[model samples]
Target: MATRSAPPSDNLLARIALRFTAFTERWLPDAFGFVLVGTVIVLLLGLATGQSPTALIDGWGKGVWSLVTFTLQMAMIIIGGYALATARPVARVIAWLATIPRTPRAAITFTAAASMITSYLNWAFSLIFAAILAKEIARLVRGVDYRALGAMAFLGLGTVWAQGLSGSAALQVASAESSPKAVQEVIKAGRGTGLIPLTETIFLWQGIVATLIVFVVAVVTAALIAPSGERAKTAADLGIELKPLISPLEAEPKGRPGDWLERSPVFSVLIFAIGAWYLVRHFVNATGSPLNALDLNTINLILLLLALILHWRPHRLVTAVREGAPAAAGVLLQFPLYGGIFGMIAFTGLSATIAGWLVDISNPVLYPALIAIYSCVLGVFVPSGGSKWVIEAPYVLDAANQLQVHQGWMVVVYDLGEASANLLQPFWMLPTLAVLGLKARDIMGYTFAMFLVCFPTVLIVVTLFARTLSFP
Candidate 1:
């Protein structure tokens, strides 16, 4: 029988379909797939290792529930805060930031410094604020490359050091070494407590000094490596300044007479509420049940509700929530997969196997050096310091116990691993890429160079500091 060939239109349609699928695959975050795959791997591992399927399923169910709830809470905060901040006229924010004096260099420096410091606030907040500030600084400079500056700002603000110093995951690990209820104890100890080995611990001064020295080196290196002349043109070309902030009044200047609450009302009431919640939760430890739930999620929910009340627009609130959903979808989806991978590690004894190997090689004297290197390597896969710490902290604590390593030394190693790989992670490049409207490939070209130079410098400093301070 003579074969009937496919129609030209059908072939064209098939090609177009293929092209569309490829495009979606290229850009859209594949976190969902990653999670699903990880879950399967975990399941397979459970079966292979003769672990009870029922237990695995139960554990996974709880982990997934926690992951989803945590992801949603984090997403809401990021989206809500971003929407509120962007709702205001960008020109006003720029004008405000400009009045800070030496608007160009100072803004860049402050933004960089603030990014580093406020990372303790929350990574999402730091990223958003730094991005906004970098955009404003770019506008003031007229011809400076804001995208590059944005990358630098992110590096300084959101880097591993900030993550390490922040009393979050790393602190929990360090405290766990001495106390089982480490997180609560560390919280009780307050920010003034010696959580970071660099800032605390008697023998680990070298590691701390090394971290500082390396940070300085990284900063100087970034400054030296920034593009010069025309190569350093404004981020305007990259579409950063395209979305000019329009005032709500300007959008409807001749509308019905503005209400009393609309005219000179405090828009920052939400910010204040969030602050009050933090203070009550962290310091006062208020007895009220409501105050207890005022974690990252509750705080964000409070802000969103406040924004809605102040704006008095149900439609706008819905729209903001819809818009914000995508902002956190990647994390929401991808973290679960990581959780699944973690499940496999736990079920299959892979993590324990790795830990045993590490313990065997880990000498108390060399633990700091080994930890610094191990952390840097791990940085490739688990880019987020907070997230990485969650997975690795337990192992580190276990290793510390096995080798009789000090909690302070362990903390130093965790920080070293994290900091050395900050410039190298592809995920950390997102804000810069977003600001620049560039692909990862383009930015990686520059960032990889920075990473190559910075990593070795940091490693050496960490090693020297560990040796000098006698951390172990």
Candidate 2:
């Protein structure tokens, strides 16, 4: 890793953060273990809610397969994104970006901002994109703490991601077909429409403002507490080596016809040409902003096509993808466990019961705050913004109608809380952890700091600015 010397000192806050890191390093289990325990917790919660053991078991079994498609999509982003980044041209761009930040604090600020801005486009893509950026920044910037960089790479998911274009609730309610029937009814009653448009949800000026405030708060906090000097644990200090990606698909001067094909660009160009046409069509027929047109498959298609063009050979891209597969293993194993947890909460009526109690105590003034907290808390268990939002929209939007609050604002509120919990959840941290070759404990301290700064920033932004996106 290149260094301009060492990162400057901020031992005061660094010392405090180190204490938390130490505790987590000592006690926090592997993320897979965390999910297993969460499964147990959800099981217990279901049983305590008077659900039959048979019912809970059935839900658990059934729920395990519910997120299978989503799991594959997440896995693709990791593998495909890594392949794209390791391409020579993309690596060069990243290398140039790394040189831009001369100091550790500036590096962290840039990373956090990059993560948030890209996440605003698409959270899944942002995870792998920012993770790659953070690693490159850590490589070029001396004295930058790897843990802080890793956390900043992940800050996108927990901070402003759910408030952006790909946010599940916003997009779900933006279309009547995608919206749950209950939520559709709520929207009709509240807005005199069958769906809540993104114009009224994520695209609302207040949501945009709140997203910006969160971006600043998180970036500032990350820079302020970024470790330096003796407190810094750069990637080298942690014994992690940065290795350049190499392709095994190089041309063979004396080999068979298959070797020639492996090294040729014909297949890749053919595929890329097809994908490019589809991308143009996708955006041209897009419903909202072009940014909103970025769903998971669309993003993966773009990444795949870019990687194909960059590698310029079908087999070379295959090698890059194979190298990236291990990073997605965590998602493969843990998501099903979370799927079961989602099933337990949804089928056993645990979520509705908990939401019911919250509804009883909430009036309009406290409603947004309550929903934010509720979404954050629920997010830890479910960990899926899209599917979980489907489960939440009915009761959550229903309560908004009852309280006479702007129903669309509640989506923003729910998103705020949903994202806040990700800092502590460790679920979405898998991609960053894998890319950086670190454990969840290694980065949780910085993410915890992010939560402290971003969560309250979100709550206040929503409660005070409710009128800006006022309901009917």
Q: Model 2: per-residue lDDT, tens digit, 150-207?
A: 9889998998888987888888888655677877887788778868778878888888
Clashes of each: 5, 1
- Candidate 2 Cα outliers beyond 4 Å, as residue runs: 1-12, 244-254, 286-293
lDDT of 1 by residue, 1-472 (tens): 3323433433332233223323433554433443464467657756675667776776666554445565565566666755654544433664476456353434445555555554544455555556666665666565554545666556653244433334244444334242245433432343333334323431245554654565566555554444434444366665544444334542423445554334323544555566667656553643322222334554575556555554444444455566555555455556565544444444444445555556678676676667767667555544545555655665676566555555565565666567656555445444434443444443333445556666676556555555444323
lDDT of 2 at 87: 90
TM-scores of all predicted structures: 0.66, 0.94
Name the candidate that leads on TM-score.
Answer: 2
What is the Cα-based TM-score of model 1?
A: 0.66
Q: Which residue pairs show collisions in model 1? A: 35-337, 115-157, 116-157, 206-465, 376-417
Each model's lDDT: 0.51, 0.84
